[model samples]
Target: MTDPYERLRAEAEAGRVEEVVVAVPDLQGRLMGSRLSVPYFLEEAARGGFGACVYLLATDVEMDTGPGYAIDAWDSGFGDFVLRPDPATLRTVLPWDEGTALVLADAVWPAGPGGGHGPGHGPEHGPEPVAVAPRHVLRTQLDRLAARGLTAYAGTELEFLLFTASYREAWERRYTGLRPAARYNTDYSLQGLEEVEPVARRIRRAMTRAGLRMETARGECHPGQYEIVFRYDEAMATCDNHVLFKDGAKRIAAAEGASLTFMPKFDEGEGNSCHVHLSLRGTDGTPVLADPSAGDGMSELMRHFIAGQLACLPDLALLMAPNVNSYKRLQPGAFAPTGIAWGRDNRTCPIRVVGSGPSLRIEHRVPGGDANPYLAVAAAVAAGLYGIDNRLPLPPEHTANALADPAVPRLPATLTEALHRWEGSGIAAELFGKETVAHYARAARAELSAFERAVTDWERVRGFERL
Candidate 1:
């Protein structure tokens, strides 16, 4: 493949590319940006950066901005922050979107009058990285790992439910009585996947063409749920692709007259999950998480990394499970972790260590389909570093099912609990700066507040006659 910039330039000159999307991953991991003409993008936005409202980093999922966030968009009069395009993330749009290319960007403060130097600045001049930005938050942790001469690689396996109803139809009916793409549990059953295969196949092929290496696609335990895994890459790049794939998958599904959701728990049945697989390597690319001579084939670094997960799981739950509905999927028997424990290839534990030698890694099963990949991966990296720095001891693996183990530590059972743990946690404040912690805590508060005020169907149904 040719250099991304060169290829884009050539395509644009030949009239094959017309528009370029400049996007930044918001707090909810949604791509928020504008589509620019290819000529304008190549001439100006590519280097000087495009202006976006600062609230992109400060607002809730509904784009509502208010007080108490780290960025405090309202206090700042909702000014513009620069979206500096990351050339490495440049790629052609999906198969269905013709004549368009997309590039992810970093949220940064504009250069001041004098232009001072600081961390998270642009290449030629200084423009501070929005400290609370999701991408910047993840980048901070990666930088910490780099200082220790280590690099992190990760892959995310996301599960989502497909509905035969179009998005507009689903919205019109308030998402009830809709037909699932698959009518029965399709777990590894070829016969039940007929309805889902066409859309899934299209998504897989399009993602491969977009430069994401496909690993596996399979039917899951739920009636309409499916899981797609992509080959792991450098942690940041993996997250970049993760967001792009999610956004594109939804668009493609809509275009096909179907709708898909990555919500953690769309219904009372099996829920969607995003299991993250992470590992460490030396700066030179030597695998550092595995040891062939060790009795268990686990290196000392691997033990500390696992220990860090146990130590930080409580404080960092907000990053893994951020939304109100997220906790609905983390309940017992939901196949979404309910306890804090680690085990060898154990599906029941939150941290499952798998593979061996160079392929060895930990699969963090805590995050659900709705998690922000950048924040969740950052939490993992931060916890691992804490363990390594403190020489934290790895405990005995929970050989039994962790969910049913009464003695095992419990993860926050609700989003409110997670927010309380995060807001009051000194560990969270230390790992991520106090400001970053506060910013996300406020985001969680907003979610909880919204849920509190809404009058749900359950409430109406239970009270209309019975009460």
Candidate 2:
């Protein structure tokens, strides 16, 4: 196998690569970074790292920053954080964008006096990773699991709705009355996908060229909605591919003169979901999630892992459901999860155990499309660790529809409730340091503030006619 960096260097020398994008995943899982010239990237940035605004990690969807965040960019003069590119994430083949290669980066505080890349800063100085950054938050959890001789493997199934109208048109119309790619429900229908298949095919092919292994792709229940699942990998790599795919998919859609949305609930119909499938393995690659000797093929470790999810789902809800729109999809009858229960092959339950032997894993159904993959996966890993450390007993599985069972404990019903649970729970602080909890709590509060201050179309239409 050719070395990824050497291959990139050769491509740059041959004029086949012009730019290298060094990006970091923000709180919303959006990639934010700079595009460097190939020569500059291969010479300087790749060795010493690239600079990005610290606010990238502190801001909300609108890029507004304020106090109360762990980073507190405004108070700190909105300084810069170094974006250290990870060689493991380098992608040399981007079929969608020619002459461009992309690499995911980690946010780190600058070295030397006053935590700035000032005088005395040298290659010998070690920069500290930003603890509250989304990538680091996930890394912390993975490190915790590793300490216990376990590694996490995961895959995410994300769904989105595609529209025939271009993004510019969708924006001009205030995102209403646009034409859907499909006129009706086309779940698993090979016939009606002609409208969406063209753009979908481009996205699928581009992702494969970008190094993601495609597992499945098909239409979803809602009109214009589609889902394409990729094969599982190490937890961190899975999330890296997820963000890249999302970013590339939008660019591809724009080039195709179409628009798609991954918002949890676009309307009253079926909503988008990001069901996370997770399993545990030993450091040496031994699968430990299943035991054939057990009647159900669930290992003792697997039982505790499921137990942890039930115990911590409420407290960690904010991580999985980060936005107010996220709760709109989690409501009952929405085909998303509402109750905190686990069952074998149960879609209605928040935690569903499936597969057998090495394939055995727990599927967490709480997150919607709006979720930040790193944070959501981190919550799952942390919850499972909690269960393993305490040896929490697995509760009886709800064989029936867990969504309709009033007896089953419910997940946080709203972002407000989720935030309250997350901030108040000592378990959340323990699992993901106090700084991480407080940082995300502030983010959720920012989202709520933004929503409260806006007068929506629904409110205007109702009052415009009534009064």
Using lDDT as the measure, the top candidate is: 2
- In model 1, the number of clashes is 0
Give the least accurate 10-residue stretch of model 1, judged by summed lDDT. 113-122
Clashing pairs in 2: none
Q: lDDT score of model 1?
A: 0.92
lDDT of 2 at 34: 92
lDDT per residue for candidate 2 within 1-467, as digits (tens), equals 85558989988888889999999999999999999998899889987899898999999999999999998887878889899999999998888889999999999888876675233454577888988889999999999999999999999999999999999999999999988899899998987888899999999999998999999999999999999999999999999999998899999999999999999999999999999999999999999999999998999999999999999999999999999999999998898899889999999999999998889999999989999999999999999999999999998888999989999888999999999999999999899989889999999999999999999998989898897
Assess every candidate by TM-score: 0.97, 0.97
Tell me the TM-score of model 2: 0.97
Report lDDT (Cα) of residue 32, candidate 2. Answer: 96
lDDT of 1 by residue, 1-467 (tens): 75458878988888888999999999999999999998899889998999998888877888998998887777677678889999999996557688899999998888764222224444566688888989999999999999999999999999989999999999999999989999899987778988898889989999999889999999998887898899999999999999998998999899889999999998899999999999999999999999899998999999999999999999999999999999999999888899999999999999999998899999999999999999999999999999999999999998998999999999999999999999999989999999899999999999988999999999999999999
Best by TM-score: 2
Q: Model 2 shows how many backbone clashes?
A: 0
Global lDDT of each model? Answer: 0.92, 0.93
Off by over 4 Å in 2: 1-4, 116-125
Question: Could you tell me the lDDT of residue 169 within candidate 2?
Answer: 94
